[model samples]
Target: MEPINLDKIAFQITLHGGNSKDLAYDALKAAKEGDFDKAENLLEEADKEFNEGHKVHSKALRSDDKENRIVPTLLLLHAKDHLMAARSEITLIKELIELHKKID
Candidate 1:
């Protein structure tokens, strides 16, 4: 297999992660406004973005496994941070949406 482009993978992860977070926040806003349909749609989009990021991350892991070593870098760290944050935000937002529904 061709050598993996770590930089590209990092950027892709960051991009998807950031998008997921943004969409999740937007979903929360929609829920707050009592637009549950829109909120659900936004959450779906967020899931898609999160999945894309995860796929890239998995590819990187596979590459590392094949090489039998891990390469740590600042960009990769930042990308991972974004992914984790997005995941957390998505979970929290889903719960908040449910709460909003109950309160509404």
Candidate 2:
């Protein structure tokens, strides 16, 4: 539970979460442009990034269990926030993509 290691994991979570969010937005943009194939590809990419972030978050949680206690930290919380926001955005973007396709 070195501080530096925790910081690294936190930063990784944030980075992957941001990447997922960005990919979802790109998917939405493609959908708006009526490029369904591209949109689907982008969405898949987003899913992959989200999974990566989730894995990091899971590892952090497991690490805490091994340490026998939870250490509350702002960076960890921020990373969790980013993960949540990315998940929400991806869900909404998926629904919007479906609606846009129907409209098209």
Q: Which candidate is the best by TM-score?
A: 1
The sequence of per-residue lDDT tens digits that candidate 2 reaches over residues 6-50 is 778888999999999999999999999999999999999999999
Candidate 2 overall Cα lDDT vs. reference?
0.91
Task: Provide the overall lDDT of each model, using Cα atoms, as 2-decimal numbers.
Answer: 0.94, 0.91
Task: Please state the error at residue 23 of candidate 1 in Å.
Answer: 0.5
lDDT of 1 at 85: 95
TM-score, per-candidate, Cα-based:
0.93, 0.92
Per-residue lDDT over 1-104 for candidate 1, one digit per residue giving the tens place of the 0 to 100 score: 57777789899999999999999999999999999999999999999999999999997887786555668789999999999999999999999999999999
Weakest lDDT window of 10 consecutive positions for candidate 2: 63-72
lDDT, residue 86, model 2 = 99
User: What stretches of model 1 exceed 4 Å from their correct place?
Assistant: 66-70
